[model samples]
Target: MTDVEAQQAHWAATFAAHPEMYGGQPSAPGAYAVELFVREGCRTVLELGAGQGRDTLAFLRAGLRVTALDYAAEALAGIEQSAGADAERLATVAADVRRPLPLPDASVDAVYSHMLLNMALTTPELEALAAEIRRVLRPGGLHVYTVRHTGDAHCGAGTALGDGMFENGGFVVHFFDRALVDRLATGCTLLDLTPFEEGDLPRRLWRVTLRREGP
Candidate 1:
């Protein structure tokens, strides 16, 4: 199989193995980010790579309408099972975010992504995804995201080579430092980026909140 197809298969297995990870019941940082967004008044949200609706459920429970987007059918099934009738509050779609975001311009009030950008794209693909995000988000819409921040220690199935690249589950993961992210968000107005500890791990994380330029 091609790289994209192999990557998709990997995530499908990962999500299937751990459905609860994406079912709105995260233990720490993930939960914190989701709670903060809704508390800050993100009413209509779209989550890219929303595996099994974890953050999506959090938003819905907080009275925010959500659209959960993931490419894995198994992941969506798990989300549906966990959400039950409340699932109606969510619109689940299967699409690759690296391509054109399957929505009209300025369609969503906010975009929330977690751990999605780290694995799914090359530098060029990331640029395209950022552009798509800019296109789909309403003027002044918020973009809340967390990506793998640069630090020490090996985690996941990946071993760090001499450089910043890692091989986790046989897929290459590019860890981003703060400067890298700032460059990527050049077009968007950055609101805030706070670094925080994740769980009992020594690794660092960036909680970024950006806004699409207002009309």
Candidate 2:
């Protein structure tokens, strides 16, 4: 299998082995996105890489309609199963992020992701992904995403895979730099950028908030 295919298979196996891999609680970025979206009067949220639906549940509990997207079918099922009372408000989509997002233009009020942008995607792919996100948002919609930046402890710790990506323990991470972040925000309004950390290793990250500019 190619590296991309291997990565997918590895994640599938990993999730299967440990259903609660990232635990059931939402990440710090997830909570932040919830507050931002709610305070901004957002009605719909598109959560990319909604792993195990921890953050998705948080959004639902906050009374926000969330469409959770993950390439793994098992992850989608986990979201659906764990949604419980919030299932009615949760829609899960299983598809690869390498391709165009399967949603209509100007459909969502917000696009929120936690570490989704720091995946194994190349720089060009990330640029395209940002464009796709901007297209799916309403004129004044928001896109809150977090990524592990070059400043992270593991940023350069693993096997170099080119384009700021490094593979460690069968998984690949595309660490971001300010230049790439700024480039991705070309058509959008860069609202906020906050640095934070997560996990036992305390992975450092940058929480970025971008708004689609319009009336």
Q: Identify the candidate with maximal lDDT.
A: 2
Model 1: per-residue Cα lDDT over 1-215, one tens digit each: 75556778887877667755533575354566567666666677888887767676777777777788888877777777777667778888899877798889998888988778777466777778888998888988888888777763443346764334577656666677777788778668998887766555555677788988966
lDDT value, residue 40 of candidate 1: 69
In Å, residue 68's CA in model 1 sits off its true spot by 0.7
Worst 10 residues of 2 by lDDT: 1-10
The Cα local distance difference test for each model comes to: 0.74, 0.90
Estimated TM-score per prediction? 0.86, 0.96
In Å, residue 14's CA in model 1 sits off its true spot by 2.3
